[model samples]
Target chain A: MKHFSLRKLFLGCGALALFILAWKLVTDAKLVSPIFFPGPERTYAALVKGLSGGAMLSQTLETVQRMLLGWLLASFVGVFLGVLIGVSRRARAFIAPTLELLRPLPASAMIPIAIAFLGFSDNMVLVVIAFGALWPMLLATIHGFAAMEPRLYEVSALLGLSRAQVIWKLALPSAMPMILASLRLGLTISLILAVVGEMLASRQGLGQSILAASRSFRSPDLFAGIVILGAIGLVGSRLLSFAERRLLRWQAVSR
Target chain B: MVVTQLSTRPRHGEGNSTPASGEARIRIFDVTLSYGSLQIIGGISLDIAPGETICVIGPSGCGKTTLLRMLAGLARPTSGSVELDGSVLGGPNRSVAIVFQDYGKALLPWRTAAGNVSLALEARGCPGAERLAITREMLEKIGLGRHADKYPAEMSGGMQQRLQIARCLAQEPKVLLMDEPFGALDAMTRQALQDEVLGLVATTGATMVFVTHDLEEAIYLGDRIICLQPNPGRVGRIVDVRLARPRNQLLTRENPEFLRLRRELYDLIKDDHQ
Candidate 1:
């Protein structure tokens, strides 16, 4: 397993190296000007400078704060409501169509409405992130709860579990792996909405900084901001996957 | 096969009799169980004497398991009522423990062998110290002390079944209900566990209601074998094995009476639609 993982790591590094090589070639060939796509060294220097004495750190922190709050809110509400809807057939029938109508409206589309309603506050950004993140988490939760094996339910019944105990102990734990999967997916959505909300509805955050830098033709600064967002996203996803691994260790032991 | 009126006959009117000491543990009176439009077991009744080991055997879907579930209070009778002690059973009775067919699923995967056994005691409000003590004792009795810390998934099929049995016995119920507990194991494991089960029953002296599909097993373990036929299942015959106590597999299989009972049971259930 260590050998396999090392080989995979090397392969991923090689792929990144190849992409960078291509990017360098395009710049060297003047296929696009430095103004449009800055070189890696220039972007790195700008990232360092921004971190040292600029607003980049605060912007990144702001983005992270908004993202965390939105994602956490979405996850809690999504799971609670999803379990409720999933367990009761009548509630599912009544609520499903309304949720369906709301889900497909893009997170980006919500920006205009958020701006109209909240006028460029952090509230607008939060609304965008939460609305966008909730759908995947909710869907995953519903699927997880719905897919519980019937035998487990029978065991719960035979053991004389109350409805609440059944949900808390059996249903929740059994649905955990799937729920974690959705949370990871939802986190990515939160990142996208976080940036978009900042870009369209708010005047501060990584997204706003990137937009501001681009307008002033500070290509390296814009790239640095984008890189920070990418790093946050990559780290967030890894964290969730790590959590999934720990929580579902029963599966590992079985294997 | 639906012996409606036959089961209604009052065999023992003492309500509760141990029959051994002339006391009663449980009495079933004209109990009929149904689901939706289907009547599964109609007007069926039996008395489980204290410390008796009774096995129910029939073809598939003969409601053998349903009867066991009804006794366990996992299922309610549609018409007549089942009684435990002298009182009518409504829901799960306090003094009954059930071991199901699927040991893999029956034992909670999250809990270790000892933890699973401890649940029964925990439900009965046993203190933590007593629970731990009883769990260790029961696991040792089932030859599973070494695997007490292991989760159900870590054990083999036979070991898991034993763990479930230990769990049921840990509850120390007066009446024990087992629903084909070894049905899913390999033949060798099944036979071995059968011996172990008989040994446990002999030691504990709890009234046991075991459900099985195999006739030889029924004869090997049961003091009385109740046979049922399908369609809407009901008791076809109640053959008293009358085998001597302290039954061992070799001795029981070697007996002519056991062989005859197996043959008779096979012949009776041959046409069952299940």
Candidate 2:
């Protein structure tokens, strides 16, 4: 519940200003060729131009939409399977090793498989993104339920809770903090895979925009695309953290 | 011969239907618990009368909590049996409730005070419309009425324990098992809660099997105190509390009989540690 203090805010802003000054100096001195590395003003100008009712706006929205959808899909599949695997020792024993094997497979490795089935479509990109984002959530949820306090089992028994009641009323709430942390992790991966999938599949999104800009040596637009992506990441994480604060207030107000 | 003699009363199903008196009686028959050759409780037998409060005092590793868990049906005796109402207790019973020593882990952290209390009611399949009223009444009984909306993390240790007790009370349990519930609280809170618990027991007439490490808690709370020895835990001694009813915190402990019992029990437990 600690708010950002005025002094900390001032310090943060000051550091940003200093960084911008240093970037300007480097560009002016031509430390790197201006053709490859655009100056801040040029990047900013390109950003404004692209956002003000340009194709970049639609492209950015497409990327955000894809990221959110893929993340949601992975979340559903991950939690459903996670809970199934978590509550039963036999389920975990039988299926966990197979999941572990699939976990380490890279998203890039799955693109060809998705293309073979989906053929460079929106579905292909979503499949890639979901596959990449599923592990953190699944692993964290399984670990969360497994690491639960043993006392709760006794408490549940004494309360005469059924298996379903134990999972719903006892297990889910107990595993929430870990689940939330994993969800945040999953969200970041989802965004990364969304951008990668777009570039590889040639879908219309910020990823394709950046790829085209770099190939065409439109350095300003490329820089602008990178900046937009970073902004999206910041906003997505902020929204998630806000949700976390609201849901976890019980753990907070006590402190 | 070392058994604590069962206090006789009309048992359940004898047309005994009132909440003021006996509704259930617990009988432990040669209950022995062993974990893969590590003997915990060896051949322990006792009879708990309907509505009688029995406090078990023992040293560490004496299987006091183990014994209580058996009564709660959380753990099954390996070689022996626990019975209720003239039937062999199989699994957890709806009419049994337990208050653990570690109340922090016992309560749901995410739930409000009243919500936590409602968990027991929910398990009982109580009607949704009736849940709120019963939850409120249970809170009021344990003096947590004002803090109904607060979470367990927001409350003091004593209040959390009280909330746990309230949840158990909501079960309307015929048998309430406690495992040193106030062992972690401050002395003042512990004494206050003890009196409150006693008052609740007096009103509800529930059978209680309380496990504690403190001799005075056993003396102050029990109609009969069962002393247990460690290293293959078995009943060491059983003393009947002849002290007067409606026991006061100060007056009850000051009684010469209380001190004598405390001295005797202390030596009984102290020997096990050697």
Candidate 3:
């Protein structure tokens, strides 16, 4: 146990150390010019400048606000639709062909269509993220429910459980692990869509900041913005994983 | 210790103490089950009194488990009907419970031992206090009070099976149908659980219809043993175990009559596979 814990600690430290080393190397080597791959110091300078100026801070706030809205909306809708499709064979049969057809099309691919129909609005971005992430969540629900033992169903029936009670008590709890896995995948996809949606068709948020910097050839700011994006993605995924652990502690203890 | 002659009289308890309108505790009338055109068990008729322990022993694919399932309301016979105290058995009746052989798949991994038992009660609409009380009582009965907080994966195979039993018993059902509940356990654990089950059954006064392939297990625990032959399963013979109440597994296995009866059952059904 001691060795295992130590190894985990070492790996975590190793990752952070690697990130600092890579940043130092690029700055020291003058790799790809400071204009393109700015040093960590220059990136920090840009972050300070962006924060001091309320304009950039508001954009940052707007970006996070939009991400939260889109993420929450997509998660709720995806899980609802997923449970519906998973439980009902008729729904599955009806939607299977259509889902197969639409699932492969990239969320980014629909940006132009979204813009055309709903015009560069928050609603359009939300729709794209929901559409993209729904597949994984839906597939997880179907698989998790299908994998449940018939014996559990028999037990439920023998107890005279109502259909709703059966679904909430037995079906949902059993499918939780897979559902959480799907949520993780959905979260990742949502982040990608948020950035892509803002980049393609938006007047606010981090994506626009990157685009503005790129257009002006202010490479330091662009690199700094990209760094922040990566940070958000990393931290967001970690938060999700932490929540999953808390929710599935029973499952972990069993193992 | 032969208590009484094997009653060859057809199971007719119409005028018994149980109210005339009330159904037989377990009534299987000419139960013939099949999968498509191939019938598995034909014309199976048996009536189990309340709290009686009946062990069905037969060769593989002799529809012993099928009969148990029929009693548990998991399956319907192709030709005849199964009734629990007069009500028709369709789907799962609230009063009947089953403990399966594959405890691995039977218990949900996400639930704790108490949670697993409590789930059945919850589904049965038992109030929170009542559910908790019954869950606690049953877990204590099975000697799993300490492990109530543990999940199935943390428990040993025997513990898991005991949890299954506790879960079934918590419902306080009138009839308990078990299909090879201990068939998967090691010999030592199986024997221990056999005694545990005998004690539990006597205390609960729940009619038990257990299916097993082991002749010794059947002869040891069963008040009456029904040996079945395969290839369109049918009841081959019935052995009345005259052993006294609260059977001792080790002592009973050593009994001359027990050995003879066990051998007789095996000999009768030995040709089933061929």
Among all candidates shown, the one with the greatest lDDT: 2
User: Measured against the native two-chain assembly using Cα atoms, what DockQ does each of the candidate structures obtain, in the order listed?
Assistant: 0.34, 0.69, 0.60
Q: What does candidate 3's lDDT look like per residue over B84-193, in tens digits?
A: 77777887876888898999788878888999999888876789998888898889999999998898989989999999999888878888888898988999999999
Tens digit of per-residue lDDT, candidate 2, span B142-231: 999999999998999999999999999998999998999999999999999999999999999998889999899999999888888756
State the lDDT at B172 in candidate 1. 75
What ranges in model 3 sit over 4 Å off? A1-6, A19-31, A52-56, B1-23
* Candidate numbers, best TM-score first, in rank order: 2, 3, 1
For model 1, state the Cα shift of residue A63 in Å.
1.4
TM-score of 3: 0.91
Measured against the true structure, the TM-scores of the candidates, in listed sequence, are 0.89, 0.93, 0.91
Over 4 Å off, model 1: A112-117, B1-23, B121-133, B271-274
Better of 1 and 3 by lDDT: 1
When only the first chain is scored, the TM-scores of the models are 0.95, 0.95, 0.91
lDDT of 1 by residue, B1-274 (tens): 3433232422222222223445567777777776665667766667778888888888776788888888988788877778888888887765788888888777767678888888667656689998899999999998999988887878888898898888778767788899988888998889888888888777778889999888888889998888876556666778888778777778878888888887888887776643
